[model samples]
Target: MRRIGLQLASVLVLLALWAFVAAMRWVDPLYLPGPGAVWDAFVRANSCYPITEGAARKICGESNYYLWEHLVVSLQRIGVGVGLGALAGVVVGYLMGSSRLLMLLVNPYLNFLRALPPLGYIGLLVVWVGIGESSKYWLLFLAAFPPVVIATIQGVASVREDQLLAASSLGAGLRERVMTVILPSSLPYVVQGIRLATGFAWTTVVAAELNNGIPGIGGLAFQSGVQLQTALTIACILVIGLVAVALDQVIVWIGRALVPWQGKEV
Candidate 1:
């Protein structure tokens, strides 16, 4: 509760400072809209359909800004890509961690993929997959894949070999050994991986949307920036931050629910 209060106070302080600066005219409204102006714009933008037919009629109907329905498309793409990428990464990472031969064969390739930026593959992904959800998925996958993979790999590798050997000596099969020994040992790492990958997911989701000209928050932000709607742009940024924080909290809650043993001191 104290931590929450401190965080709320910090946010309020920042907002108050921003209001002061904007009121003092320390920054140009064209570049940095005043806090009051941003609040007004947000009210205007959210009060009505900011991406409605009327909005299009007001702001050039055929532009990228013309998309009012693409936000849902972007959300779906991110959901699919991030979900699959994280799952695959955890599975493959565990397989590699368990088998030395598999690690040797797959680790180099995984490292190679990790080294490359998502943008480096955008053109190829677009050419191969076209401009649909597949391309966006590929981009988002690239964003989330590495963190999960590395986390799982490190988690499994760090487990005590003695525990596995003890389970084996006790007549435990490979499945039993994994469930009783490997999984419990590596759950903390898996949680950490999920946390890291979520941040990647958020970033990659927005970047992919903007690059593909998909109709989403990122596209909205890009359009507002292009049109010099600084207030709306700031509002979009704030929205993104809030959404990311919400997602992080959700992930943390899941981790706690799944691994309550973590709460007990050893």
Candidate 2:
């Protein structure tokens, strides 16, 4: 109860500060809009509005590339990209960790790729794959893949030799040892990697949507900025942040369920 109260109070303080700054015109309204302006923009985004440019004209709300559509598109891209990347990273990381020759062969390429900024390859991806869903997926995959791979490798390398010895002394076969010991021991690191990858995936969404003009939160935000709709842009940014937090919490919940023993200090 106390913690919740404190959180609420903190939010209230921030809101108060924002209202003050906006009311005082500390920043130009074109660049910074008040909470009320943001709320109006949100309402407008959700409500039916007329388009004057069409022959017959039509009322459009969120149905025509609105908030929900943007959210869904972004979520789908992130989900598919992150899921595949994490899976592939785990496999490659395990192979590299288990075999010195494999590590030697793959290390240089992995280092080079990981060192590059994820968005730096957007132009290359657009050229190779076109400005389609495939490009966005590849961008997000690159954003997520490296962290997961590095984390998995670190996890595998951190496994204590005594644990392996114990498994061997118990007459465990290679498969059994790997399944029961190696995988479980590495799960905490895997979860951490996934959490990190999720954030990276979200961060990459804006860059992925740059030229593709895909219906996503990032694209909406970009459009809002281009139109100088500061309130709408801020609203879109807030939505993105809230969604990221919610997704991260889901990942945390899954991690807790899968590795209940994690952080127990046993």
Best by lDDT: 2
Model 1 C-alpha lDDT per residue in residues 1-266, reported as the tens digit of each score: 99999999998999899888888889887887777887776666644344565564443222433333434555677677778888999999898888899999998998998888777788888889987767888888888888899999998987787888889999999899889888988888888898888777787665676565546777677877888889877877777777778889988999988888774532
Clashes of each: 0, 0
Per-residue lDDT value at 14 in model 1: 92
lDDT of 2 by residue, 1-266 (tens): 99999999999999999989999999998988999999888777766665775546666544376677788889999998999999999999999989999999999998998888877899999999999899999999988898899889988997888989999999999998899888988889989999999998898899988876558888888988988999988988999999999999999999999999897642
Q: What is the TM-score of each predicted model, taking all chains together?
A: 0.86, 0.94
User: Any residue pairs clashing in model 2, and if so which?
Assistant: none
**lDDT accuracy of residue 266 in candidate 1:** 22
Misplaced by over 4 Å in model 1 are: 49-74, 263-266
* Cα lDDT for residue 135, candidate 2: 92
